[model samples]
Target chain A: MNELVGLSIGSIRQRLVDCQLSTVELVDAYLSHISSQDRALGSFLHVDADGARAAARALDQRIQSGDDLPRLAGTVVAVKDNITVKGLPATAGSRILAGYDPPYDATVVARLRAAGVIIIGKTNLDEFAMGASTEQSAWHPTKNPRDPERVPGGSSGGSAAAVAAGMCTVALGSDTGGSIRQPAAFCGLVGVRPTYGSVSRYGLIAMASSMDVIGPLARSVADARQVLAAIAGYDPDDATTLPHVNLSARAGQTSLTGRRVGVPKEYVAGITDQEVRDSLSATVDRLGAAGAEVIEVSLPTTALAVPTYYVITPAEASSNLARYDGLRFGQPSDRTHGHGAASARLRGQLFGREPKRRITIGTFTLSAGYADRYYHAAQRVRTLIRQDFARVFDQVDLLLTPVAPTPAFPLGSVADPLAMYQQDIFLAAVSLAGLPAAAIPVPTSGQLPVGAQLIGRSGDDNLLLDVAEGLEQALPVSP
Target chain B: MSDTTPTVEHLTKLANLELPTDEQAALAAEFRRIIDFVDALRSAEVGEAQPTSQVTELENVYRADTVEPSVHARTLVETAPHQQGTYFRAPAVFGGQP
Candidate 1:
């Protein structure tokens, strides 16, 4: 069991093909580990032991029958609760969605199942994927496996923590403004936010639809590459998914001989931690040593990304979440009078502080008088942000920047709402630009992990993955 | 935009939220702070630049106008708090007099 839990997907596949490890044994190992160890971590909201056992037994039979196995065969994958699986309780980490079971599987979930991945459980996350930390989840907060006192950076905190703790091989997390990357950075894992519209968002609970992307959080770059390949492609259900989506990650170029990696000047300015700065410098030096030309490039609109994201996200969220009016789903409060009054009471009762705050901000900004001033202005600046990336990509193949201003801080330390929003300062812009970026942990001198993100042009996801693999090899993380 | 800093009452009314006095006061303060923070976008000169509402280049996607079976109406209403004959039940929109 100990050996089974620690093996990578690549290693597991080789063993499974050789009949050294049965699918049932793999599922039982992960389930037992979760049962004994997950109490303190609070990573999983619901562990589907019965369902996992049934699937594993079926896979074992197929393996015995000499049937060809799928790519993700015999691997355990944990999903963020927001992404629905058929008959699984998907609350999107909100009390407002309590007991709401999705009637069908999300496209990604269906894809994962089709590829022979056993979904172990639904994990915890920020309510509606709103907060930077998973502290906002109505259920218990997910603690960082590294240090239980600190937070596993969130809205995808549970998935990151589960992978970090060896509870699952690889987990799927939705990155809407750094939800996946931030937690991966904090937990010392490789997280990728694919090109917007590259992965189908048909089943992902909407949070800023334009920026929300479903991605993989895995312990190694190779595993992330496999998971991305299995799930990324055009889906008929999602019109936003790109038609010519390419799903390949090859390490054809071992050395970064011709790659020109950009280091954004703005990212280094306000980063006060010398340790974080040094870790980033070491990563760049390694890339340079590997023959990649690392140069300082400027994205002048970097500072405006956070504000623009906050404005645009909430504006869309306000419109998207308007459907939850205590009628079709969730429990409604009894406030006398008519439908209008009851919905008002219901939302007021069920919404968490962050959701209410965003709703208010959204309603205020998109108001008749202020719509042009705030919402339109933010969108126009979003255009400028995208232009900034487009112009910089012309000069360099990719940009290397710090994943966050700092590593995982102690949980409950950030109480102020605006301060919490600042956690994504370094990550939100990539989402705004609809670019592909990968976050890999750099071997830092300190105890906590610090990650550097590689940002590539839209549809250059394969290139970024290859680069991430190169960086991972250049500066291998210590266990 | 009001004379004295914007109150949660106005925003709540717009957002269809009902809050007690204390929570409203707290919400009002937080709202003021968030709005102030977002005001930083005013510095960027976005003159004549087109707004990018959607990042994906695809637009006006059309599918065949054919009917496909979907989740039954009963299945949809099964999760609702109150339902009557496969219909989601909600409080009356009009006032009690109706």
Candidate 2:
């Protein structure tokens, strides 16, 4: 492994500040590492090697001029392709938008650039951020760096794999129904899904608008926290961004004494994998040993989360993706036919199997005569799901659950879409309620890493990070 | 709730997607399974609970009405697959020779 690639963001910053390592050298190291390692991993769809080198050179000159460095200076970050980076082909892992390159940067990308972070490349994802595995990606699937046969989880699989394999310091991934956290768990990295409205959604190709949030995947809780802080805050471009949001984690707080952690019984009830069950038990024991009170809590509507999420996400996705007609900035179809026919042909030919399935499902649910039963009912149940979290949060400061039922499953193992949807059973409910959740790797004797999810109340993102940091410190590193 | 499974033809027409004839049957089966799975939402008793379309409670967020400089029309139009001047070029909507 490259020495610079193994260094964390903090150590890299220290090295840069000490004049021991130049930003160009760091970027070159990562670029070379990516070029050599990424062919088999398939983590990146578009690597901006020139762009990254240019940015690093500019930063190195600034350092020589004695300018105050930005908070995340000298860090190389991989963005999931769905989030537009100015002049990069933001494919969203779909053929529909294959050659489309946005002329402007996403709010998060702009912020990361302003923070002196190098835009390394655009990582792959499931088509329109839909599937649990990168197998659904229009491009080749991203393999888990840990065990190449298994998936890295998705739709942020590429981002997770990039960070896991040390291709980048940290990467940004959008989470709607565990896209970020599941991949983090699979890759043995820390992934955060910040509370909805906490981070601006501008420039993100919308999948499920209401539940969509762009967060960070890093090897440490602290790195995730720093990246989240840089990208988070109000943006006029995105009306959903909350004003007066506080993202500061408690300073130097690592002890979990007197903290209240709840284990939702429903989240763990269906775990058939003995390894996952043992991992959860070990996580609970670690939390207890850290002086936190662990109590069993119930979220009865938990089972309804996947159904609700599937309905609502597809419904929103259908509407959001309606903008992808060939007339716009995507693949164009032969225009000998009428406009309507052209649109049908373009979408049919361009969209992958999962996006089409979702669009059809969304149209079905929201169609006349069916909206009352499926779409509206799911919305009402969404309220109940949120209430379940609201009720449980009143008793506990945070909740702990398994990030996924098992460790990363082998690539191509889950074929059925419904079976794949079941993978989010422990994750979708948090998304439905628009809560903040983090997936941290827990020690497991097995070859693959198991992740424990720490779900916090809405806007308590900092608390989640603080506790995760503490637990991360307490737990023995997985060998 | 009606027990009738949605036909793929109806859904494809509604969604404006042209599924290949060979793939429709497989997609139809997948759609049926998904619809059946999501039907579980109907079992939850959501008595008197209002729908939550957006999580953020902020409503009627309005910005100043004053116009701001926007992306250049040419810059925006350049991204389109086909463009005429500053406008996107598309197949005739009225189904006539263009």
In terms of TM-score, the best-performing candidate is 2
Model 2 chain B is weakest, by summed lDDT over 10 consecutive residues, at: B1-10
| lDDT of each residue in A1-479, candidate 2, tens digit only | 78899788888888888999999999999999998999999999999999999999999999999998888999999999999998999999999998999999999999999988999999999999999989999989999999999999999999999999999999999999999999999999999999999999999999999999999999999899989989889999999999868897333566899899999998788788888899889989989998999999999999899999999999999998889889878798778887888889889999999999999999988988889888899999999999999999999999999999889999999998999998899999999899999999998879998999999999999888999999999997763
Interface RMSD of each: 1.7, 1.0
Clashing pairs in 1: none
lDDT of 1: 0.90
* Superposed model 1: Cα runs more than 4 Å off: B1-6
What interface RMSD does candidate 2 have?
1.0
Cα error, candidate 2, residue A370 (Å): 0.5
The stretch of ten residues in a row with the least summed lDDT in candidate 1 chain A is: A247-256
lDDT of 1 by residue, A1-479 (tens): 37788778888877889999998999899988998889999999989999999999999999999999888888799999999888889988999899898888888989989998999999999999998789999888999998899999999999999999999999999998999999999999999999998999998999789999999999998899889988899988999999889978445465687799999899889588887899999998999999999999999999999999999999988888888898887776473678888888888888888888898899988988788878999999999999999999999999999998888999889999999999989999999989999999998889999999999999988889988998999998886
